[model samples]
Target: MTIKIITPEYVVFEGQVDSILLPGKQGEFQIFKNHAAIVSALVNGQVKIYTDSVPEKYSKYFTKENEAKSAYSFAIRSGVLEFNNDKGIILAE
Candidate 1:
């Protein structure tokens, strides 16, 4: 599924990802491809993105070592995540 993480200044991340793990207000939640439509509030924690099919050029920035084994994480204070029509959007504050 395509994922987009946006902050007030700029877009944090935008790409296709295999899975996403976030700290929700209720609890931690995982989002995968074709997930049901929903919106939830996020808490203070890390937002992990698993990129299985990222492009080579962009992968260099987000990936630490290798593409397959590497994942990207962002420290979020508070935010909202929305999933709909096979797309995931995160707006962080």
Candidate 2:
């Protein structure tokens, strides 16, 4: 799946990802490849990014924890996230 995180000033991140874990208004949830269409409110919290390999350009904004998961994460302000087909987008304030 592909993901993009955008703010009013700039596009924070854009690349292919294996999964995304978001802090939803109701609770935290993970979205995977080919996830069903969804539109949800997000809370200010951590956003996790998982991929087979880290994109070098965006490495500064993420931290790789364990090799098995190849997970990276960064804090996100309040936002809205939408997913459809193989794409997911986050509109952050």
lDDT of each: 0.81, 0.85
lDDT of 2 by residue, 6-86 (tens): 888777689998898999988999999988999999998888888776667777777776645778877878999989989
Candidate with maximal TM-score = 2
Count clashing residue pairs per candidate.
0, 0
Q: Global lDDT for candidate 1? A: 0.81
TM-score of each: 0.82, 0.87
Model 1 lDDT-worst window of ten = 58-67
The sequence of per-residue lDDT tens digits that candidate 1 reaches over residues 1-93 is 899988898777888888898999888999988889999999998888887545554454343424447567678899999899989889997
**Residue 26 lDDT (model 2):** 85
- Please report the TM-score between candidate 2 and the true structure: 0.87
